[model samples]
Target chain A: MRPAEADGGARPVKEVRAFIASRGRAPASLLDRYVAGFGLVMGAAVVGRPIASLLGGLAGATDPSRAGAGTALVLLACAGYLALARAAGPVSVSGGDASWLLLSPLDRRGVLARPARLLLAVAVAAGLLLGLGLAAVLGAPDHLVWRLLAALVVGVSATLGGMALAVLAQASASWQSWVTAGVAVLVVLALVAASGQARPALSAAAHAPPAVLGAAAGAAALACGLLVRRALAALGRIPARALLAASTRAGHVATAAVRLDPGALTWIAEDNHWRARRLRSRRWPSLPGPLALAWQDWLRLARRPGRLALVAGAAALPAVLAQAGAVSATAALGMVGVLAGALAAASSGTAGARRDGDNPSLARLTGVGRGPALAARALLPALLAAAWAAAAFAGLALTGTLPATSWLWGPAVAPALAAGALRMARRGPVDHSMPIIDTPGGAIPTGPLFWALTGLDVALIGCLPAVAALLGGRMGDGSLMAAQALAGVAVLAAYVLRARRAR
Target chain B: MYESIITVTGLTVELGGNPVLTGTRLAVAAGEIVAVVGPNGSGKSTLLRCLAGLQPAGEGTIEVFGAAPSDEGPFWRRVALLADEPAWYPGLTAREHLELMSAVHTGPSRLTVEDALDVFDLRSRADAPPLNLSTGQRQRLALAATLLRPSDLLLLDEPERGLDAAFRERLAGLLDAYAAEGGTVVMATHDPLLAAHGRQVSPATGGVPA
Candidate 1:
């Protein structure tokens, strides 16, 4: 607790409490809370009974394969959580709080304590949920209540430990470096599990003796408390400017996530790229400015080898699924089309979005109009998506999964979709909601029309050829090709027209 | 009228392992306008942040209104700060943001949302989203929101940034007027017109020169 004299006996923390208390409880017009509560109750009732029955049925049915699968799944989820925590540490504050309250003469820990505790509680709840699910799946529901409690303790331990590492990374470069190393170790463990070399070890840990597990849980809780205390102490010493920067970056990540902007991830990676030396003197060939701009965009993607790997991996998913008989070749190709469409949506907006988001003034210095500049910017992403689509098509063809003629869809729709997405992204990241339409129960959100337009492009590019072939067969293949080509050309024309109008 | 409201001694601060303000010292009195002038990368903004208790001192101390600023201290309730760069929540409308500032302020504020909007010449764009506003409008909105509430100490870091010459003059007058009302004003700027409104303090080698 902060001393009263910290604020010259005025007790700023107490004032904050008073401010909150003065607002009273929920407002009279907060019907949304009831609506949300009703939804939650309905969701639980809908989902709970069946899940309970399934767990009851699976109890005491200890199949080694199921246990192995459950262990692998839990480990993968933990890895994902750890990686995410490493990338974007624990704390989140609005820009308003950073500017106003962060500089205020209030106990920093007192202000941060509630939010931090809430976040930690959420993490513990999530862990409990995951652990219970895993325990049920692994056939440890004999003494179900006790088993669940044990699992909860372990889950809380793991979550807090991960959080502690993440927060420690903020103050220590060495801890930050350990994050990548931890990821590498997780990858290795996953590889070992896949090879069946680590299944016994995982299964043993899953079914450890109750006494041993309890002791481990106690030790973990103690460690977690110490880590939380250390992190809060370290946080007090951290520069406010650093917190502000972190808050801004977190805001960008949140925005990118909400918008489902794939390019945003690339933007984050680009922003955080660690270079040995600043590329101050690096120069490109003095070709025409448009070409130079296009080259720069391409070079950015090229330098980030990880992004290229992701593109190739995404492009290969459909073919792999087809090869494994997970879906039909036509369905596989359509799935690939969806992936390509999403990639187009993400990569297409890269250059223009970066310009608009970070440096609009730099964009203005080009001396060119929006149309030409955007058109030039569109080229690199389009070509890249086309290459990815082509690679996917080749993989499908090589594996004898699809006819050679189906390859035509890749070259045509990929670039067209890319161009369309580029135009949509160049409109800027402003939220433009359409009017709400009246429904029987209430008004339904019309949502962002930009996303609807992007979805239309996806349907045109990803589903058009697939739907045409399903109805037409080999006899109608030529006609379907012509239709796809024409549709692609139309989309391209619309993109060009929009670009011209943008200026 | 001139009562020392802020005092700093041997204030050293580091950012990203590099010392920005080494052994800096300063004093500012009530009803005074002090311009912190320095070239880019100089510790002008840093000194102001230290005074406002935004940045932690690596060594030495800072006193605001005869007491050090901390999260549990009333010292912040008497201070208002405006940073050069705008930091706005994307979901908020300009009007809603002003309303939020008014609501969150610990002390009494004479300015309403309408007053702030009209004063900042943003009445027409009050309902518009922040992302819709231009760079200059965003800067003005930040300033308006910060200045909405009355405060004893006003810290403005490069307030002239992103503003036109006309707005710059208006800002100078605003600072002078605030000073005349017995408020302390410390602004970081390179604009000579704005600097001329206050006693110039060059912050070249970490500490401000007398």
Candidate 2:
């Protein structure tokens, strides 16, 4: 055993970290400290007004009709947070630390302490947001301060417990199953809440006395503390190989972020998922050349049934939001959310196009003409976007946010969404050399900005008719739908034709 | 007499103000195999890229199929280039990748997916994703994908990379069989066994036959 392992590893690990830190770059100068402090102050100043306004909005009694949907939304958001935390390897070090320290004979818990603290900080911030959102949604009928505090306590406890559960899941398979079950339960509960079956309970909780609320918060906090203790103990038991794999994934994510290349993140996730999966080879379906080439995307989408179900489930989110009075307040926000969700759904089917764009050796080997291949590729995304947007629109219309015929807008704009998704997939890495223009607020780096807007630009331009009609409450108009369909088809055809001429 | 499939004369490539290949000359005919052997940074891959019309030569004339090579669909239909391992499509098994290759071509594949898996000794792991395979296995999968499709000419860069001695020899025979089927191959190789299977040339010596 190494020397560090002799005396429980903690002291040695600290000494080593300090030694490395001392040998590292100079400490921040006074000016650097000043700038950081000034930035924080300015940020707080900018965020303060909106937060105050939001708090003011939380003063009234909860709207009974909106209570169930609001509660469901809150539950769904928490579930999403937990899932993201689990996926991110809630306990992971930076690439440098992972390389140098992770495999050493230090106390595993000691090595993980910094990352654990970082996770805590992130969880706390997210919990605060969740708390604020809950307070705003459920409303404080009286004694706003005490109710808000209770809500904050409950939110923090829930996220802290969820985060602790995620950490435990990393160390134990049994815990992983529990986390999965928990997320499933949350989703089911959300559906129940959205259906208005939970209104009585939600209404009672919203108007509960401060003493009862405090007791519930106390129970939650106790559970959170126990889970956290278990998680801290479990840290030492996490396998080295698992930690290494998670660290490598985190390194790739960091690299992608540093490069401002969001597209690379999808590939990283894709490759990681497949690397761990066991798959049986299936015979390729007989199809024409370009269609055969495009069939991989279809096969890929079919393979991930859970993801498809999640996408299907998310179609109800717009209606839920509208019922919660969030989307109904802003028509533009509602339309944007629908379009964005459709584009994301479309993007899920464009992995094959993305792979070819990154490295076209397979594409070249296939030897399919670009136009025909692209046209074939567009079919799946267009179909996916069409279905997703239509479902979302139907939900919104049922919620009285849109007209009865509003679902027609979904298919009309789907081709453009598909075109946008394909464009996004093929948009290569961000070019950092693009000019940065100075603005009053800050210097705007056009490189990443343009990279981000590349696909959205096409989608927005193509879906302009739909956007205008939705905003104008003209979804019942037949002419606008016809115009949107024409525009969508034109955009997709133009994109494919241009791609054919490229290279 | 065999028809000439490719001819290059006075080929020069400069990258970032440095010459990688200077005054290179090469000629290949149908059913011929030429191995371009050179040290690292000797522009072997660059020469292959030029042949595929992917790299722009600073000064040279490269004629493939009696026309300047073009990086377009029709040109690729007649030529297959396997340099670095292509990014395998996610969620695809090794056999599935070969199947995709066979499915996407109108012409008959040289080897069926099952035959390729058996020949490449990947039958056991054929159902696994290429990412999960060992480096040599992934290389074999790439080769399977490359050769399974129909092409008149093959450009292979370091085809022996990540292969064991036994597999390398088998690959040499496979290339011979490919050439025997009235196709042309120009590969860059570090393995003497693979190089000796073809007319050995070096980019250092302007790609002249050695």
Which candidate should be chosen as best, given TM-score against the real structure?
2
Model 1 root-mean-square deviation: 19.8
Write one digit per residue (lDDT tens) for candidate 2, span A326-348. 88724687778899999999999
lDDT of 1 by residue, A1-503 (tens): 45765454346766775786687676556678777776788789988997688557645645554455445556656767778776665665665566666788766666565557866886786677666655664556356655666667777777777777777776566677766776667656654553456667756755677786678778878887887778777766556665676777777777777775544655555445522212221234445444544444554555556756756656655554444343455463455454454455346335543544343322322223455555666666666656676666666665576677556656556546666556455544435365777764456645554544653564356446645664344412776667766676666656656655542
Indicate the residue-level lDDT of A199 in model 1: 60
Model 1 TM-score? 0.55
iRMSD computed for candidate 1: 20.2
Candidate topping DockQ: 2
CAPRI tier for the interface of model 1: incorrect
C-alpha RMSD over true interface residues, each candidate? 20.2, 0.7
TM-score of 2: 0.97
